[model samples]
Structure formats: structure tokens, C-alpha cells
Target: MKQFLILISFLFVYYSTAGIEQAPPNFKVRDKQAVFVDFRRAQYNITFDVQNHRALVETKILFEQKQKGYPLFDLVNRPLSVTIHDKEVEVSLIKTPGDASKLRMIEKELPKGIHQVIIHSEIENGTRFSTNDRKPDWGNVSSGFFIRDLRDRMFLEKYLPTNYEYDQYRMEIDVKVTGTKRWHSLFTNGEKTKVSENHYRVRYPDFYTASSLYFHLVPINRFVRYYLTYPSIDGRDIPVTIYSNYRFYNYLAKKKAWKVMRELEADYGAYPHDQLIIYGTGLRGGMEHAGATETSIVSLGHELFHFYFAKGVHPANGNSGWLDEALASWRDKGYQTVDLPFYDSANLAAHNLYTRKTDKRSYEYGRSFMGYLDKQLKEIGKPGLKDFLRVFFAKRKLTTVTTEDFKSDLEEYAQMSFQADFFQYIYGGHMPPESGHKHVDHDHGGEENPHHPARTEAEMLSIL
Candidate 1:
């Protein structure tokens, strides 16, 4: 009896430590399952047993299967059970190479037609902020700061399993959270309804190809809020919330975000989302979600711009990520001079923007080219980049964009060849500067361009 109990305890500990690994290249490939299976919706019913430091989760996935194929599911290590089309089936857990703890689901010989998959599981969250290798620290807040948001916790996928890009299938989600923890306030990227005492539900429409869904359970009693309406853009009033106790947290964030929104709106038509929530804690850098972005006030504008570029006009793959990063970083520097200091034959050819590798030269060098392009457009008596973006966002709204899409649009707008310029900078060749300056060698530009007066130290402060 003692030996059996110990064995069970060891197995439980093993599985608990094993988390989901990063998806591999092959996982991105459209298998026969992807072609035959049309994913419809996912309904998540969750109960956060906070006292126990765990969540009991049940998720139902509805899909139409066109032909016989094996569908893949990304469960966190392992699921307690999975039922497909009302039939109980055995599931095999395949260990990933890079991360042994991470897992992928493989089921054999699924039949064609409408099918439903239900997953039952429990996810442990108490260690999210600890030194646990499997859990990230995003859920942790400072002593006075408390964030119990669904983003780091109650998202259904974290408990169950799904593809990396689940939002690509045009799937809607309904999430319900029930918890006895009264210290937290709940908010999600969905329509909210209180079902019962301590029980709440949120419904989301097709969330415009959201990469992930998030909800916040902030601890503060109340935070400063600001409301602004851009009637020319959307009928909805944009509500900006600062989930921080610091003085002027709301004012500084609202001011910076509003400035960026108006600037981008003038160039790109309307801002992409309805509401904006800014968290003043637990952010190393910043992140852009469907309708919200979390960052300090210093990076408030840059993160908000991601709504239009990264979230609005998404990259098709890692190779094209430069599109969003370059544009945002370029705008971050207040759109300074067109002459980029970091351009050469070696760096250009050695590393093109189309590779999946992360080298951040794409941000600096790539952004300089955008500035250069804007300058070139101005010189040719054509509309500047702001005009170009107005058309780009209008046409490619809510769609994944590729580099080719950008090139084709620029060509039509400029009425001149642009690929030659791309070859020089983007494809790894020398783009001789029109000012008779050598392209292969130039001074590395300062982080902030001298032409644009630098932001004052006080203005850069996030909290006061």
C-alpha cells in the first residue's frame, strides 16, 4: 500500500512539471486534418478554486470534418480525458524534442463529418510567479499590486489544447469564471454577464483574428479611467483604464496612447480596437492584444501602435514579422531622417528580413528603410507614408499580410519600380544614396535622431 501511494505521487509530480513546449515547424504545416477539419467554436467552462490553487476546466470544440485524417491537439502535457463525437477514445501523448515536458496530442483515423471534442483537465496556477521552469512570471504582481487576470490564467487554451494560431479559423469563444476569491475584479475581452454570485460569463464574437484572449482580475478597488470617442472612426466610445495605484498613472497613459491613436488614425483610418487597458506592473517590455496593450507609460504609444500594424495587419509568418516591428519602431523615433546609418553589403545580404531568425537589426535597419521610402515618396511629389498606410489598412483590414502584398501596393501607389530599392536594402545589396553618400559604410546612428528633440526625462517617467 505504501509503495503504490508513493508511485502515484511521483507520477503526479512528473506530469505537473511537464508543460507544453513551443510548437515545431511541422506543427505549422497544414496536415490533411487541417484541410478536412473546419474548426467552429470553443466553449470554456472554468471554475477557479483559488483556495486550492487550481482550476477545474472543461472545453468543448465544435468542428466539421470533411475527410478521414488525424487531428492534432495541444494539451498541456496531458489531459485527464478527451471525448470525440460522444465516443471515448484513447489518446497518445508524444513528447517534444526541445522540451521533454511539453506534449502534443495525436488521435488516429478520425471519421469525416461534424464532430465535437470535449477535454477535461485541471491546471495549477499557484506557481506561476515562482521559480518554476514550466510557468512564466507574468501572473505575479508586487505586494501592493494584484493582478488576477484571465490572460495569464483562465484562457481556455492554457488548460486544454489547441493550435498555435487558433484565431485563424474564425472561432468564437464563451468563457465562464466562478471563484470565491472576492479580492479580485474580473474583466475579459468579451461581453460580460453575471450569472450568479461569484459566477460570471463573457461572450466574444469572432475576435478579428486575435492570437490570444485575455481577461484581467485586478486587485485595486478602483482605478482612474478616461473615455474618448472618435466618431469619425467608430461609434463606440474608447474606454481607457489604468490598472495602477500610482498617481497620474491614468493621465500619463491616456495622454500618450491618445496621441498615438490620433496620429495613426489620421494615417491608417480608424484604430483597430474598442477599449484599451494598461497595466502598470509585471511587464518586462510590452505586449499588444486584440483590444488591450500592457506596458509602462514610457512605451505606451509604441505598444498601442501595434493594434494597427501587428494585430491589425498581422504577419503571415515569422519572416514577415519585420513588417510590424519596423513600422512601429520607426514611428517610435518620431519618424526621423531617411538616411539609415546601419546599411551595408554584408549585413543586408547576410540577414534579410525574410528569415525566421530573430536578429533585431530588422527593427533598426529595417525601420530606416521605411523612413527612406517616405523620403523618396516626398521627393517624387507623391503622397507620403501616412497616405500609403491609409490605403494599406483600408484594404488589408483584419487579414494576414505578406511582404509581397506590401511591395505590390507600394508599386501601384508610387507608379514606379520599388523592388530595385528592396533588392538593395531588403534583399542584401547596396542602395546607393541619392545624396552621393556611400551605402556600404556610414556612422551608426544614435538611438534617438538629433533632428527630433529627445523626450525629457520627466516625460519618460511612468509613475509619479
Candidate 2:
């Protein structure tokens, strides 16, 4: 027993210090005040016991502190133990700014240097196991499902120790499943490798943020998975995988996905991610993860188009979230151009500094602005908004962008001053009128969808 304990301690220490000398990727910090430390890499070893309904997670994060300050990492569940550079440290939960919940903040102040932090936690409420004859919506008899959709700041921090979306770092996850003999399959946006019968390892890119990862583990037989290789116009054979609990919709999903991919590739340059993963929920609407999506058959095209916009040129904050949704909704509406006078005030890109939720008006009001821009561009003998998007995606792939970044890029591309339009429509909450025409009131409400509940400022205020 003494030798076993020593071995475990040595292994933990070894993992904590591994690859500490390497330099982290040089990515610009979006919000420096919100995130103090620079995250280099994060590694997690998770063990899930289906029968016991337990999930044990061991995490090691390597980061660099440019200034002497206290570090903050968000985790909904408190850790059992936390060690900073092999020294045990105490942590406290404080109310996260602009969020309704709290985050775990380290109490000690550290010098400006690289540091290794280790955290151990057990997830009790995040995993749901099957009970009696009823199966959970996400889990089955021999498996458990873990999903982290970016709705109202629910990222990897819901189940793991993670930084915010402003920080991107390389991540590796080691998963082990126990109390089940059935084969389990892992679907994610990372590069996966099978280590053993029930042990799997996944490595995500160095540019992945907390919201960029899409992870799901389930029994192989629970869902029907369809795989195909799409020949891209950029001379790459992209692997596409679509899986769902219902098998009958898999064929139609694949066809729609193929058609959408072709359209997106023609608009954009190429598929930006390593692979395409789709979880067809056969529902009404969908949520877009980086390279993967949990979408309905009707919303498959819209979700897949996000890989080039939302996931490709990532938004750094809530204020910038309207760009991708507006672009996608415009594309979904057949890229219609309109010449109409705007009268309503709906500020979609003006939110608090710590806010992370996208505005609800991004669906209809933001889309109308896109159409208005398209008409303005065409009238000036320039290409439409689609052409500008193609150029924008080509230049800004795999990078974080803000509303100002989009405006500057567009101004540089079009060689015109859109400052007034952006200030009035996006930031100032008033749209500029076009010609002598009847003003349209877009402030009635956003398009109602049953699947996606409205997340307005009023709702957030209520939650707070």
C-alpha cells in the first residue's frame, strides 16, 4: 500500500510538470481584466463509473502569469483538492462578474512566471445515469452523456476547471469508463485515440477556447452513426460523421449536410476545422459548437454554415456575437437584399464587459441590417455582403474577432465609411433611414422559436 501511494504521487507530480518549459501559443488576449493568467495547456483525466453514478476528474493546467496577481478559473462544482506548483492552496467562490453564478478563485498571489496547477474534483450532478426503466434524455443504460452547449455561459466550466472563451489553449483529455462492458464511442472535435478497451485519449488544437470543444460519450449501439468522406473544392477529403438516436433520418441528414457543405465551401474558401461532426437530434432548432453541432434536420444547413462563420472566426465577447448569427440568418433567408427605412432601436452588439450571452434580436433585427448593408453595397457598384464574407473568412479564420474588427475589415474591403451606420445600428441602438419610405419597426420582438428560448437582457436580469 505504501508503494502504491508513492507511485500515485510520483505519477501526479510527473504529469503536473510535464512540458512546462514549452512556450504557449502567442494569441492576443481579448479581455485582460477578466482573465489574469495566460493559459498554455490543460490536461484532464476523467473516470466515469456508470453503476455508481460518479465522475472523477483530475486536471493539470499550465499557465503563465505576466503580472503578479491572483489567478481565477471557473468551475461550477468545487474541487476536492487544489495544488499550485506542488503547494496546496485554498480557493474561494466569488460571484462571477456579468454572470449569475460564481467562480473558483485562488486566494494566494503569485509572481510573474510560469506555473503548474493541479485540481481534483468529483462531478456528482453533471452526469446522469439510467434508472429503472426510464432513460435520461442524454444517457442510456450502459452509458452517460456529457454535453456543454454555449448557452448563457455554460461551457466546459460546468463540469471541468476551465478559463473563459477569451483564452485559447491546447487541451488533452483522457477518459476511462467503468462498470460497463459495452463498447463506448466518443464524438468530439478533438483528435481521438483509443488507448485500451475502455480508455480513450483526445487532443484538441492549441487554438481551442472553452466553448470550442464538443464532447459526447455514449454506448455504440445507442445511436446510428453515418460516416462519409466529402471531396472538398480545396482538394481535401473531409470526413463527415452524423449520428442520431433515430436511424431513419440519418440518410436525409447526410444529404442536407453535403448540400450545405458545398454551398458554404463555394462561399467560403474551405472547411476550416479538422472534421465535421453532427449530432442530429431530430428536433426544432440547433446549437453550434466549434466544428460540431446538435441540430435538427431542418436546421442542419444553418448549423453547418456556422462552422465557417461562428466557429471559424470566433467571437471574443458577447458584443461581437451578433455578427455570426446575423450572417447565418441572412444566408438562411436566401440572402435577400432590401431597401427599407429603419426606425426601431435594437442594440444587439452593445452589452456589458463580462457578458457572454448573445442578444435575442440577432435573429431578425440583425439579419435586417445585413440585408440593408447588402443593398447599400450593391448600389455603390460593389459586390454584395456575401463577397465580403468570403474575403473576411479567408483573412480571419481561426482567430478571435470583435465588432470593431468586423467593421474595420469591412471598411478596408469596401473602401467606404460605414462608421455612421455601425454607430447608429449596432452600438447606438438606432438604425439610419435609407430613402423616403415608410419606416419598419423591428423592435416588436425577435423571431419566436420553440426550441431556442429567448435570452434577452430582461431574462438575464431576472436570473440575476
Which candidate number would show the highest TM-score if scored against the true structure?
A: 2
Instruction: Estimate, for each residue in 268-316, the C-alpha lDDT of model 1 and write its tens digit.
Output: 7776765666765423455556666656676677777877887777554
Error of 2 at 93 (Å): 2.2
lDDT of 2 by residue, 48-107 (tens): 876667889999887767666677777778899999867899887765543323556687
- Counted clashes in each candidate structure: 4, 0
Q: Once superposed on the true structure, which residue ranges of model 2 sit more than 4 Å away at CA?
A: 1-35, 96-101, 124-126, 131-151, 340-343, 429-464
Error of model 1, residue 399, in angstroms: 1.7
Candidate 1 TM-score to native = 0.69
- Clash number for candidate 1: 4
Measured on C-alpha atoms, candidate 1 has an lDDT of: 0.52
lDDT per model vs. reference:
0.52, 0.70
Note each model's CA RMSD in angstroms: 11.9, 8.3
